[model samples]
Target: MGLEQIKNEFNAIAKTIYFDKAHFLREKASDEKAVRIFLEKVERLLQENDRKLEELYFVYGVFGNLYRVIGHPKKAIHYLQQALCLAERENDDSRKVVFLIRLGEALKYNEEHEKALKTFDKAMDLSDTLQVRKYNDFIFQHKGKCLLELGHLLEAEKCFLEALHIRKEKGDPELVASTELAIELVKKSK
Candidate 1:
């Protein structure tokens, strides 16, 4: 196969491993072994490709998210940082925002609330500068969680309310409900 064809095939396989199998394991089964298997496959693909492919950022992102699902926040943070570096090297601000959010979540999971807040703030700033409203609610919601964990209840409520407003406009019932629950938690904590 030509080099382009090989790259295409690699990207396809990586996407299936990440979006299909890994997501199913995380959401439906929560099977750490299955996730590990998929993770290893992707890692092997990265190695065989010499990590020079265009999809390296995506593969690293998949690794980070899979680590998160298996409750390995530190590992997730490492991979996410790698993904963010690759995204930055590609000059992909949109992908940078996404990686920042994922990194923030990993930090939050590891109880690094202050660092998570900083990461989320960076995501929010990038999204705003890019005029990408799609990720606004997510940034706000995750930032709210970090703030809540840090005992900044009022700030957390503000972030959750902002997220709720955006999610309501987007009409994602699940997202709206999630923000509402966060808001309720903030209120109860007060």
Candidate 2:
């Protein structure tokens, strides 16, 4: 296939990977095999055409998320970092924020609180600049968690409250409740 054709095909594949109904099949459980298939498909596309660095970052981010879901924090961190670097290289603000968020989450789970805080801080800043309010609550929620881990109770509470406010504004009652719980945890720790 021509490089342009490969680009189009890769984009289509990525879209399907992200939005495919097969992914939401509760009955299939779509476990390890499905994840592997998605990974392979993306990898093959990359091998076939090497110019779509942004798409590679996206696929890496997706693979990282899957690794995170599978409870592999280290692998998730590695792939997320790859995605982050590529996103930065591509100057893609949204993708950079996404990889930062994933990297922050993985680092937070690994107890790398300081690094995670820095990563989440960048993600929050980027989200603000990008006007990505959809992800603000998530960014603040993770920032709160990282601060809480670092024993910054007051800071953690602030972050959680901010997250709660965003969730409330966004009509995400579940996240609002979760942020409230975190807020309570921070308060209790004090």
Candidate 3:
């Protein structure tokens, strides 16, 4: 029918499939399979729709996360960088933060702690601009991880404390406890 109708139809199906959500891959095996299938359809849709940059960005993000979980940090970084560039072009602050965080995580897992820290720092700046304290908490947690890896125990502890404060403010006892454990680890490692 019309363009709007086509978009509505795709959006309806997309919500159920969640092909663009990298987090969905962390669910059960069956769910991951479904996500992969949906991803195939999403790829086809992007091709059929002229490979729109917005759609490509989402696809790249999903693939990037998938690669990361599969232990291919290099591939993950490549795809994530693609998504990051698109997010920057669109000026999607929230998505940019997410990409940066995930990119940092991939770098960390790949033993590229210095790069990871830089990415996390960028995320922190964006989180401040966005006023998302939870994101700051996340950034601090990850930054602490990088610092810990770098043998900066004191800095790591400080970062963990900052994360703990934010988590406590958000009333997430579980997160606060986790951060506390991280702090303990820093102390023990020292």
Candidate 3's C-alpha lDDT?
0.72
Clashes of each: 0, 0, 0
Residue 149, candidate 2: alpha-carbon lDDT:
70
Per-residue lDDT tens digits for candidate 3, residues 1-190, read: 3335434544543444321123311211224454455446655665666665655766687667655554567977988888888888988888889889889978886779898999999898888888754578888887887787788989988999999888999998878876887777777788
Stretches off by above 4 angstroms in model 3 are 1-58, 130-133
Better of 1 and 2 by TM-score: 1
Instruction: Report the lDDT of model 1 for residue 168.
Output: 92
- Weakest lDDT window of 10 consecutive positions for candidate 2: 19-28
lDDT of 1 at 62: 68
Model 3 steric clash pairs: none
lDDT of 2 by residue, 23-75 (tens): 21111123555555655765676677764564566567766766655456787
lDDT of each: 0.74, 0.70, 0.72
Cα distance off (Å), candidate 3, residue 32:
11
lDDT of 2: 0.70
Greater lDDT among 2 and 3 belongs to: 3
